[model samples]
Target: MRQANGDVRVGGPVNNRDVAEAHNYHAATKHSYWSVRLGGHFLDWANKPHPHKVYQGLPVVPLPCDVTPPTMAALEAVAAFPSMGTSIRNLAELAQVLFFCGGLTKKKVYPGGEAQYFRAASCTGGLYEIEIYAVCGDLPGLSAGVYHFCPADFALRRLRAGDLRGELARATADEESISDAPVILVLTAIFWRNAWKYQARAYRHFYWDAGTILANLLATAAATQLASRIVAGFIDTRVDRLLGLDSEREGSLCLVPIGAHSPAAEPSEVLPIAPETVPLSKREVDYPLITQIRAASMLLSEEEVRVWRSGFAPSPPPPINRKCFPLNTIKRDALPNRTLGEVIIRRGSTRQFAQLPISFRQLSTILERSSRGIPADFLGGSGTTLLDTYLVVNSVENLPTGAFYYSPSEQALELLKEGTFRRKAGYLCLEQGLGIEASVIIFFLADLDRILERYGNRGYGAAQLEAGIVGGKIYLCAYALGLGATGTTFYDDDVTEFFSPHAAGKAALFAVAIGHSARVPGRVKLLAPGAR
Candidate 1:
């Protein structure tokens, strides 16, 4: 599978057009320490794209204002993966889920005409590029239709007023979860929205940003007793066409089926749609690589989607001779008092950590609970994951400062090397101070050789996305315990090397820092009354 330029050749038996495209894109966009420094990329603030997507001709159906706030304890919500027996039968339940996933949560104004709007989850560069749409059957208060969620107005714009879930089910190859779903949420990304800042790398954020939002959405659904699972394998063009998307500028990324209902409506005639949308920017710069990668990863037909969804099981890691310190986790009954909704409303990326030691129990709870795994189509089963976690202990009580590997199978941490690597941790994380001061810096890595060999290039996205979802959970988990956490960028190669021998041949996928905040301020309440 190796190519001349060191790019993995993704054209074997399971490898298809999409796989090859992903490989080419990945090879071209990789970041080396020197490559990033010499790129000389500069942000053009004047050309920044509009954050919110608006449809001009559609009549809006205002969602129900009465949303039931979630009361489930934060840790319980993180650990809960309710069965598909539960259903979201009303508009109120749907409204609550959407609000917590993407609704505006906090607003702040700064001097010099600057303002920042925070959402339910964090995004890179604070650039909200992901847009959500819903396809569903008739519910208690909502009629069957295809609708776009407008976060700016908190309304759903009717794009096509009819049950379109059948089309989506077909697009996903009649995947049981989507076919049984009363409502399916389609997430898309507008290339220029984030590309304006990160350029071609924005492609990765397509999954990262969406994954973070999914973390919140999944938890919110579970808290409300609605069954939910993320569906990543689908016919990309079919989904885009169903949503009337112009694939050049914007494209579909994933489908999330929420709640269970009766069998899917019989496949219906898909009508042609070309709704007028407000232009995002005066001028937009096109990144060819982004489009190329998206096209390459797309499964072209329902048959192809079916074949693609036959995901491979990742091989278990090689055995190691090391003492494993099993996690000492608190039971659900003994979890912190704060609810998941409450924690999300107050969660923010820690700007500065106070170099203080956190209890070993706090760190262990985060690992044990968040690592229970996510419910997604790509994963083989519940509690199964594509990424392995590694941590650098900086200041956790009862834990010696060192680099360690977290064994999810054993629910324990295996000591890799014992030493004071605070300075090395900071350097690996691009010299960020948070890396040195945090109680623990967690890194998510994966064996790309095995991943790509088994699932092909699409597995690349599956790996990074799972990392973000897990990382986002860690963010919420830390906040529930009254500690602070933040996701950070890192020198990827350096991370694998820092945890070398144990993390040998594994590629770094994501990183998050957990610690006490330097400043403790009251959380700003932004939800409407009774709206969590």
Candidate 2:
């Protein structure tokens, strides 16, 4: 399953010659035509690769030792460490980073008595395929080595001996971030794990789920005053080998360098070691298309990596005259005053939305705050949005319950179609009730044809990142407003269909439901950095 270089195709036959051959300018129209005329083959769910990757008859080694859980408040408070110039003096800091990023956040029991442990961030389908490994020098409490984080036991299992951070730096062409940081967090996704439920498109989930976790991590790092950036361009195989991951089952997705100004890491003198990890699930499943797509989009040469690192292909000029709203401006005092720390600690995806209505002011503030310019190189300028926003208004004061397109250009909602489609909303979101019950559901739709033609595979990264940045902001905004929100997976075609004519030709990027939660005051824990 390992390719000599990263040259795998992403979408395979779905976005191939025949599909691309169609001159479909409007995605919603194209989607509607396919669903109504072709009997539902356009947005292919049948081909969704399995979401979980199961391995059987494997070794299960307990992590070296038990580690203490970091103080929740301390964990949440230190979003960026180096910003404060605080040195990481001992082994405890490393443990804090590992646990906070990947530790279990909560547990729940089902009617059948089965227990499910949720993680630090909400994931689509709660299917977590992302895995984290550490590469660093020996610190205060532990030895220098490559180790995989086992969230179940809250311990680290050594995968290789000694410092391999230099090898990683070289693999990334000495990506400056990795070279200077004391510890680098390497993230990889097990193909079959998420592919099982989402199928080939699980490839996107690799980044979507990852982006959410990265949001938490970045925020946590920011609270700590540590400089962190997401690095995608690198020699894939070299990093895979260093981590001893079976390229067939899992591969490196991104690398995050944390902390600054420690002694330079020395490369390991020992040859590459391939130690075995115990099997995680019962039986291994295969998703060839997903593997194929991931491999195709991979970066091979340092030249290709460098070439693909930047540049958005020539985007078609914006419409000479399309009527869209300029995003509404907000008064500073009217905005939610909760600090970033308070918001993150209290945030959780809404499971049930009260039919009770949210105030027009609260809703307006969220739309404004979440749409504010994101800080990204891909964004031409601050406040630039890569994707358009559309909404299904179930209920809002002074607003009709129908489908509306957010003309950020006009800062007003353009009524696309006037109809109550609560049932349609639920169906579009894989039949989730939250969509129907929420005050309004926001859907991010992108012009992928333009994006891909301009940025290639990296465009997908930028789009998802933008959605995540805003989505993360949405979480903060909602919590600060005393509302609730949750990120969700949706039926691609149905969303476009619901917003049709207006949303034609656009592809679904991300979905989040905002409303109210059902938990009691103290039921949901809220801890910030340094808090217990």
Q: Please write out the lDDT profile of model 1 over residues 239-322, one tens digit for every residue.
A: 998899989989998899888965668868987799999888888877776766666666777777777668667677656578
Residue 174 of model 2, lDDT score: 69
CA deviation > 4 Å runs, candidate 1: 1-20, 111-113, 331-333, 520-532
Best by TM-score: 1
Per candidate, the number of residue pairs that clash is 1, 68
Error of 2 at 468 (Å): 3.9
lDDT for each candidate structure: 0.82, 0.63
For candidate 2, what is the TM-score?
Answer: 0.76
Give the worst 10-residue stretch by lDDT in candidate 2: 21-30
Best of the candidates, lDDT? 1
Each candidate's TM vs. the true structure? Answer: 0.93, 0.76
